[model samples]
Target chain A: MDITDNKENMTEAPVLLSVRGLVKSFDGKTVLDGIDLDVRQGEVVVIVGPSGCGKSTLLRCINALEPIQGGEVLLDGQKIEKDGKNLTAIRQKIGMVFQSYDLFPHLTVLDNITLAPQKVQKRPRREAEEEAISLLKRVGLEGKAGSYPRELSGGQKQRVAIVRALILHPEVMLFDEVTAALDPEMVREVLDVILQLARQGRTMLIVTHEMQFARAIADRVIFLDEGHVLEDLPPERFFTEPGTERAKNFLHMFEFEAVR
Target chain B: MPDLGLNVLLKGKNMQRLLSGLWTAMRISLIAVAISMPLGILLGVLMTKKNPVVRAVLRVYLEFIRIMPQMVLLFLVFFGTTGAFGWNLSGELSSIIVFSLWGTAEMSDLVRGALISIPKHQYESSEALGLSRSQTFAYVIIPQTVRRLIPLSINLITRMIKTTSLVLMIGVVEVLKVAQQIIEANRMASPNAAFGIYLTVFLLYFIVCWPISMLARRLEKKWKD
Candidate 1:
């Protein structure tokens, strides 16, 4: 099978995020090694890997949630370390949707969505609420604005999480297996919202177990094994003709009938 | 002595003094709890930091507070501090200071335990949501900690109130102290008054502590359900 590279370096397609020569280790166990990646505007990049392959750590490093042992991360052409910008400012422009949908138990769904904007951004309450309501509507959770997290279904909670992230109007969204904790029947609803976001040209970095969604939505797919990117190709080639034997083997592990 | 009727007891000056002592004990307890709760929470957060040195220091502090009896702590703060430092402190102030210090350490340890007991995944999930550190603590971590801390803190409050009697040893003149004084005054006139006065002090402590104990239980049930 022929390798397909979907990376397009349009002059207008400025690099919105970049990671170069990234390395990290925990207790002398190297989890990421000499990695480089670039995410352009409006691109959806999906990372797939076997368990313990450092995909999550790589995503965490880009967000600056996990400290990087070496190398640099640039957001929107600005060097994160050299600029001395606070993580909060950088994080404000990056939304994250987690598999567990970590909604605040003390807050109503609307409060969860509006909290950071109202508190951190200092937006007026009415204006924040208005934006939150609209975002809630976008995620099909308008009815859940006043409900506590415990009152919502798992799917509804994840959708609320999406709206919560979107409320910040982030330039990039990171999804870490957002469907992993959902019931099988509820997975499609959350994935549908993600697919819609991708369609609207949101730059997304997804560390996902959902191969089908990755195939359908990713502009570029990266397969990782043993802390290294085994294959960086378009979905067609990534699924059909993975470059390294490690990628092939990693993909095979998910083929267990029970995993479906 | 046997048939001291309710009407007679209510009209007696002794009952009034006993009531005053009860009020004073309640005041001391409330003030101590109010002062200690926030300090406890701050120390609790500090205890959970990633630094082993900090954790070890906090652990030592917690064990020292836990192992030493409260009565001994009171003596150290009240008698020892005053004697050693030559600080002129009032009895009420000294009592509040000692209890607050003791309670703060205990409550802080409880808060630390509750905060650490939460699944690490909760924080990871919050981080995955791109929450700022403060947002992660305020929204995700603190709310959960508050629920767990409430019942335990109330338990501490109840313990504090009941233990305020220990302050009478240092002569703060709370309920138990008042009871001893009244018994002493009436010892020649009424032989059994000592037993009666001691019983009354016991009842006052029970009345003050029982409601708080019940509230803690109820909070546990509500959170569990």
Candidate 2:
């Protein structure tokens, strides 16, 4: 689809996940309040905001990694959280990559990538190994299977993490500032893996400050201000012409480079 | 008796006693550590919770175990508890109970320190993985905790072996006690046997603890490497 047509069609895309009235408080401070969000299947939705605007907290709540005091997270139009516990069956469909690569250092790179599948999914060793090899290739690190995480560079470790998450074959991937901790030059390599994933039409919900990444990747960009969405617009409109005063002011932090 | 000291090694009687005593001590240590380390790890994990009341209660229990002497604990279990409660109990049983309690409390605190010493980002990253709580513990948090745990546990085993001497006070025939008995019986006829017997006991204790210490050091160095 063309850029203009994609923009017009995004509003009509079927919602794959829906959230409502999410609230989270820590030590008498509200980190998230009355937040609502929707993500369409095969769409990349990037949540952009300044530090401490609760963007990360919002991403966490959606995956039930961080419990919400009040709200609902519906995946495929069904509630993922029932009573108190997060349904593992549902969580299996959503994977997360962190700012710091949490690769298991004790395990070999192949083992680290296959651990979740072997343990959680009870997949056979041969099958899991095959999947891990294919995922390693997909992330452009097939040669590093035998290397330990400590032996790899930060960018390589992050790429390994992306592969680890993708190995689960989740319907949605959550990226929480995945390249925030890397060297400037290394950030591109990590982002390039993500950019490749985007080109494959993987559904993603990302919380990031990389305005250029948000502009280039996101089908829709969400601007959050103080635990609420200030503006939700198509990337072309959101970057070029943000509607709310808060969106305009928040974009100023990106220095208009995102637009050009 | 001039050549008898070295000749004693050829007879193997002393070796038998030494092996038996050492084996008994090792058995006690292995059992104590096996039971206590897991308990301690669980306690340590619970101690780090965000709840203030839970932390305070665990703190009191841990400090009490730490401050009270393990020997006194043995005396209380063997002598005082049997008298106070009208229950028959053996000294060996009491020794196991006291040592396990001591080992557990110390091990638990070590576990807590190791787990907490890990950077907070590690836990956060696991959470970000959408791993369930059990999965997080099994996959991410525990592997790191256990690597630190192995060396610390070996050190605790060594401590437990040395501490088993205190059990002799309540009447278990451990190495030191056997040496004391042999020395007491031959005191008049062989006065220097006191020195010899005690030296033998010292060597026995040294043999028991030295290998474990080496093992602990090797593990620590390997993990570091």
Please report the candidate that would top DockQ against the real structure: 1
**Segments of candidate 1 deviating more than 4 angstroms:** A1-12, A256-260, B1-12, B49-57, B74-94, B114-148, B170-172, B180-199, B210-225
True contacts kept of 1: 0.33
Clashing pairs in 1: none
Q: What's the distance in Å from true for residue A82, model 2?
A: 6.1
Candidate 2 at B61: error in angstroms? Answer: 4.0
TM-scores, all candidates, are 0.83, 0.82
Residue B100, candidate 1: Cα error in Å is 3.0
Writing each residue's lDDT as its tens digit, candidate 1 over B109-161 gives 89989999777767765654445668788877888888888999999999889
Q: Write down the worst ten-residue block by lDDT for model 2 chain B.
A: B3-12
Candidate chain B TM-scores, in order: 0.90, 0.87
Which stretches of candidate 2 lie above 4 Å from their native place?
A1-8, A82-86, A119-123, A254-260, B1-24, B27-59, B82-90, B111-144, B181-199, B221-225
Look at candidate 2 and give me any clashing residue pairs: none
lDDT of each: 0.81, 0.80
Clash count for each candidate, listed in order shown: 0, 0
